[model samples]
Target chain A: MSSDPNSTSNAAAKPADGLNDVHTLSLVVRDRPGVLVRIALVFARRGYNIGSLAVSPGAAGGFARMTITSQGNPETLEQIIKQLAKLVDVVHVADHLEHPPLEAEIALVKVGVGEGSDRNQALHEVALEFNAVVVDRGKATSVLRLIGSRDELQAALSALAPFQVQELVRSGSVVMDKGRSVLTDLLQKS
Target chain B: MKASVDTGAQRLIRFLEHAGVEYIFGLSGGAAMPIFDALVDSRIKLILTRHEQGATHMADGYARATGKPGVVLVTSGPGATNTVTGLLTALMDSVPVLVLTGQTPTFNLGKDAFQEADVTGITYPVVKHSYLITSAQELPRVVKEAWHVLTTGRPGPVLVDLPKDVTQGPCDAPEPETIDIPGYRIPSLPDTEALDRAATALGQAKRPLLYVGHGAVISGAGEAIAALSDKLQAPVVNTLLGKGAVDETGPLHLGMLGMHGTAYANKAVVACDLIMSIGGRWDDRITGKVDAFCTDAVRLHVDIDAAEFDKTVTSHIQLLGDARRTVEALLPRVRPGDTGAWLAQCQAWREQFPLTFESPDDDHLRAQHVLSRLNALTEGKALMTTDVGQHQMWAAQFCLTRANRMWLSSGGAGTMGYGFPAAIGAQFARPDTPVWAIVGDGGYQMTLCELATACVHKLPVKVLIINNNYLGMVRQWQELFFENRLSGVDLEGNPDFVKLAEAYGAKALRISHPSEIDDVLSEAIAYADGPCVVEASVVKEDNVFPMIPAGAAVSEMLIERPTEKLEKPSGST
Candidate 1:
């Protein structure tokens, strides 16, 4: 359901620890049709579950950047990195985890405020505590939207226990490693 | 890019042109402005989309249309994140797409950076491979590697994350190399021992059922599969994905099996002594509850993916390699079995639950009639790309799929709006093949903008829009499930699709009368100068019968319109 390959695999096999052990990498490519299929086929063919992903284009016309998280030992990540480096559209690749970066995801969880005004208030209070928002409210249920780190959302979900969880949807994780130098430096002397 | 002077942006565009990339689809964003500026005078065409998801889907459409790797470019953060759904669609459907995203500065990597999303991590599982360029110098080599990974193996999405600084950084334009994957290659031949055991199994079986799946289609082994089916005197049952692997008109053909499959096909599979599955995984939809599936059959599973064999259905014999090669090797070894009893049982079931469509009396646009007319018009020379919906099922059922590699539909992904773009891809792959995109109203609107792509490329793909005024599949479900609650399925106001086609600079034709189908289709197909759209607005309430209401077993299917209803169908009566 979620496009995140690692999430599906992780859900199927809950690694006792978390996904931090996984290797993460990113790249820039020309944005074109079926690019995702090309990427997925590589991972699927090799039986690798991508942990997280975010993609966007560059300031110029033809290229875009894509970041991928994969759960594997160093050797597997090396193989993936090497493989990714070989695509014609790929312009660059890096290990963001090695660089240390800020990462987060947004999730919208719809819950049933069953049987009382207190249950509704409780759900709203939890959202407020997490700095979340109520994206939509309906007669039967209220949808609470949260944007935060996976840890934060998980904490928020745990806190909102009384209301029966109706549906859970999440935006794929996005990241940028922190530093002072802007990406535009290569094009212009800052 | 000049030999002596190559900006990071120019280097990226030049790399794309060298890789044979024809077009780029995405919106201009803050992080991507420098790259767009570089592409202003480049050979690679840039197409801006309404949204990032649309950009990816457009690229997916292009890939499906051209069989060339589709390319997408989006900015970091929101632009990057919006691509998940499109990436997911391509991933599920097996489209080769290359997605590129821009990031903030490398130094601003982890401090909750602005417009910063880890495109690689989020897409890791969804894509075949992904990368974040730590250094600008590595761009050229990485680009080459992305292509190799995309086209070589089972093609899917690949992503590359470019830090803004890195995209703009100067580096020697590295020479592109013919990248060789050390450990990734599609094996051509199965292990000799595995083939030997498979041949032995073929030699012994009294009644073998050739259960073909999408792998046969993927491996381009449909003809070989049919030949082997004949050599073994086996009835071939196809999964939904494997619809045209073996000709449906052939005597040995048993239609389809699994969810939405024929009753006789399911019975034949269940009752067979040996079921040799080529490229099928015995997915839950096809097998129902695995324990209760093909109980009597000794399954001979052949697949390129070794993990698929015996992963679900128990395999008596397994062949791991190309389906055509495996089947061809076993063809000489397999001897005809005295399957009179087995064939008779299969025939009996077929007679009991035969696939039929009533020839519509009122000149009303009938789905089956249109398909049959299209079949007659093309004479099995065309390729069919169907969007997943009621029309897809109808097209699969009614169309005469005699040629190998003629059927193209989203089997694994069941994606809508897939037909038009995918048809373009299929046509591009084999330019000689006349490709028809059979899409329903709802599905056509999903990726309708691909019309421009087709026109721009001068692809003369015929578009057959089966307009039923609703999301036919979901409506069918509502009719079956919620007793026609019809919530969220119906379209409130639909555009005149025929005129809409003309607006896109395409030839448009509409066939409302049953009698007009032949003439309209001929004229549409005859138009070779540009793309064409033929809207067949069928009678609104028509239901695709042989309906297996969701969760009901294959046997509990409605084979035909009820006797009372059929008998009372004449308006005069």
Candidate 2:
């Protein structure tokens, strides 16, 4: 008797600080057309808004690794993961925050250097403090790259806000458990 | 064995025979001619359905009626798309079906050739797994592995998309082997620690409810569930598909517990302090509002699918294993006690708010009354297949099936036109058992062409079309919620169903008066020779009660209208 799930629960419980309660999900899914859309539909159908999403070819061929950051109640997110795992195309799903997993995000900060101005030197200092690489040093701009946790990247971006930051791009956090096992080895052998 | 042919299609037939696929329901098309040729020599019987959707539903019916997997063969394009609803039905209900679809020639791959569909791509989300055959030699291994996946833990439909060229190539694939899919895992054994937790919960509760779902049927754990419930003396509420998991007539059984379920069943769900959900997902229909469903209950769910727990109602203890194994393991581990006061309260609710329908004063009969009388006559011994509508709900509420594998319907997809063909499949699967399809006027018209298939096969199955000249369920909804501005629900121009049945050469009967049900059913159903159809023109605007509207909590169930019986016509039955 389970029908259209748009109304899964009456008015999903959204905490006062729900927008800030970010959850990270890792998914291994079959690489096929509309696979991403299908996975997104699972989350969207559950009324969870995506904070950020990143997908890359997985370690195993013919599969993709998807990292999703969303803000919702842990209960609802757990339900969403269960729904996702129910999909045949989804190989494995994990909540990184529930376990000890390695998480990283890379960002590029191109600040307007103003042709050898003090801002360029200050940006260099900030890059050194945050272990960011000076990827490019053009006449009018200095593009610095930062690879760190979401919080660290946010702090670095805040630090570079003083300089005239021209353009900024960040890859959403990608996560995997910090252990000897992989999703395929764990899920397949379960 | 004599030297046999090595053609891919022939080898596939041999594999299906080896897997004990006795019946294959399908419709032939351009891409699958070789397999049809091979089937001429195969041992399996082919049930050529009037439509591909009916074929899939029939397979679904067969699989649900029997514990074994059902097999289906269809060609590509629309033949495959027509299967979507049926596949979704099986996938949602976790019934095992193997769908073999013949794809366009491999060389025509992405050219959108005649009757080509990306079957694998389209069905990825609905199937347990699907494979587009890339090698002719791998056909045997694919068949073996597909069987394993189809029948294993948390069983669901699996699709094997066969390219036509592969059917023409030589099948020199290695002999079948035991399933060794590295990524697939059977559910874990009954967790003793989890059982210990559940036992403690069950031991402490004063108001415990045993809620059985289709998982009990899937695991063949009806006896175990009944034994557990008997020992605890807890009231049992079945989900729609869980009707037969516990005999509906059992003293402790509180018939289905959801929308349009018995009032007592819905009341028990909200009032019970402890709810042990067995093999049920607590779907939105079951749990009207997830947060408020069993607000005060200490929840424990035993499901083969681990994904069920916390997905809807968060459980305190989750037994992640097969229902049979889990129930068997916990039978001795828990302390035996009865919910005396709690049981009394439930009994009070059951007694005070029993299911009832007013005796209309008109000559036209009430649909539910007919279903109830059928139950009385058959003693709930017949296997029932129902199409979705008011009739399906009435059947769920009235049909008193006494055992598992006797109630089959399109529970998940709620597909119309599913009952007649499914009745065909169920009768074929269980030749000795009486199979009756309880369908509505609107749904019956969708697949009435199948009456010929039934007559041709000479299967002794009875079909009761509850004729109200409208899509009763939708009409009821519109009447209640849409201020009676009924839109597309009317079917006043429906063909005379009895005449239609006679046209197909099946025994037919038409009953309009309330007094004719018993005689007509007894003569045509119990004593019928082959296929039979009974079209009963039921009272119009008759609504199914005990409904929990969408997005409402179970506690807020709309039991009955204030003037519902006041408007009943004069001739009381």
Candidate 3:
């Protein structure tokens, strides 16, 4: 972002020395043009690598919800969350690391024929292990939907990758913290 | 109640009226005709300027002087582009301004129609917030939101871009008055615990310094800051934008700290154990090398914006809140701390490397002398605006401002041509008050067309054009750091500034001899009619003294130009 190599730079300036933990942040923002770009830019400009991002319009309100995941040390991670909270479009940024929400993801894996023709049975076996269901099928392609936690979906996609995956569509992770505390409550307190 | 105004631009005018805007510094152009037409029937004054850049600077100046968000109106294309520099200037200085720009029609946006521009895209990085209004009904909401964004935490320039067709189109009625943006709530009240920690730290430190920044002035916490300074017996050092945050005549005041700062201020920064930075961004200029700047000190940063907190200078305690409120809360929690020995040490440093100027080379007017005389004539009663370069440093060093917010300059961006037009805005803000525009020859030429604006409005701002015949600051840098290459720094074909002012129907005077300094300045100050321009050809190569040479430590300061071989300061910040 800046050539600011100052040792006294903020916590975000720390290199990933022993950082192994990843954090997910949920944000409620105005459903306006360039809102996503502005939020994405904060992550991009500050050298924070975004592992995943998902934005969906709120069901009841005119606002939109954004869930972003990135890995950094707690020191650096807090700085990123603070920076995100500063954006005008961003209403609230709740770090899910503390609450450890019920995470879910939906992935669609399309497997092709030719090289992986013999592995069709193996792929079906892998899908069954992950509770995936075959949604579409043709002579050369098989589309399966894997609905589970982010890790389960990622493992299922990896299992099918070796079988010549024709295409992959992943719905990024979305999390809601432990029981009774809805996102609306978070918005209300803020 | 049925509204009298139905058109988009008329609705915008009605919104501004509700917002209590007094002036809209602007220029008329093809795309902005709707706004100009609406101005005819509104109570708000339209301060017409010769250039769009001048219009933005005037708005910035008005904001700084009045502590209210200044409003600007400009057409699309070049008029919108022209505001980039002024907007950057305001953004860097944290001046709140509502910039209204006309854009091409929605349908004409991507087709490159006449007077079209991607103004919103261009200013996204420099503005606090911006919008390209798609519909006329959204104008009121955008206006309300823009004002909310501009005047709130860490206020900067916000733009509400009105499409030409939208301004001309018919639309639904404006929304209800209570503009409660669900997404944008005012920041929570400041943390008292953090303030308590900061107060305790101040109470215990043996050597503490009140490092004031522009936030002190922006928050109008001059009295609170002064009270803290008094209670602690701590010396006060200000950044350039924070110049008038406290009375310059205070005994414990260290004028300014940074590249061209007083030796004592820089030395105090290095020696102090606790640096309480109030509302000031620790800009690159202030903290030469961040690690070395107040390296040993515990920084207590108080700012309204959390982004500014610990962004540059790492703070031991960050009190994120409005400047005025933060200071007010701290006033009662802390006791009168003692730093007498530290004050004495700082006094010793001040005496060791006093900010002084060499005697003028014969009859060439010394900038310092002229500034000193100006300071005395105004008696610290005038609103002073300075352009970037040597004259600005001279004013910052020599001028005595009696109160906070009395001085305005493009400090953070260091933009040239800000002073003259800014003076015009300051004059309008305080109609009967005296205002001075001290600008260098090169910077002055960039926006001298604004003299016409002052004349037409009869603003009565005193313009002090310090004609040094060169881009003085850059030339000074070239001399000290660039081996005196002196390429493209000269203003050889500069106009006769006095004649230029006279042609613009403004009173003009030229002073060359040293003897005429007092009389010419006195007459210019006494003039009660329209604006006046006083151009004095000054020493060309005179350098500002007590400079710390960019990245040098506070100890490595030089009061006078080195006569022997020069050695650059060691260690980058």
List TM-score (chain A only) for every prediction. Answer: 0.78, 0.84, 0.81
Pairs clashing within candidate 2? B361-B569, B361-B570, B361-B571
lDDT (10s digit) by residue, model 3, range A1-190: 2223223443333455537777889988878887877777777766778888998986546688888888866556666777778778777888887668889989888888534545767877987899999898777888899999888887887787777888888888988777666577855554
lDDT of 2 by residue, B416-521 (tens): 9989888888998999999999999998888888887788889999999999999988888778766778999888788988888898899999888888888999
Off by over 4 Å in 1: A1-190, B1-68, B73-83, B102-116, B173-188, B344-352, B427-432, B455-458, B561-573
Candidate 1, what DockQ? 0.02
Ranking by DockQ: 3, 2, 1
lDDT scores in order = 0.73, 0.83, 0.83
In candidate 3, position A62 carries an lDDT of 66
Model 3 score (lDDT): 0.83
lDDT of 3 at B272: 88
Candidate 1 vs 3: which has more DockQ:
3
Give the lDDT of residue B157 in candidate 1: 90
Q: Which portion of correct inter-chain contacts appears in model 2? A: 0.12
Best by the DockQ measure:
3
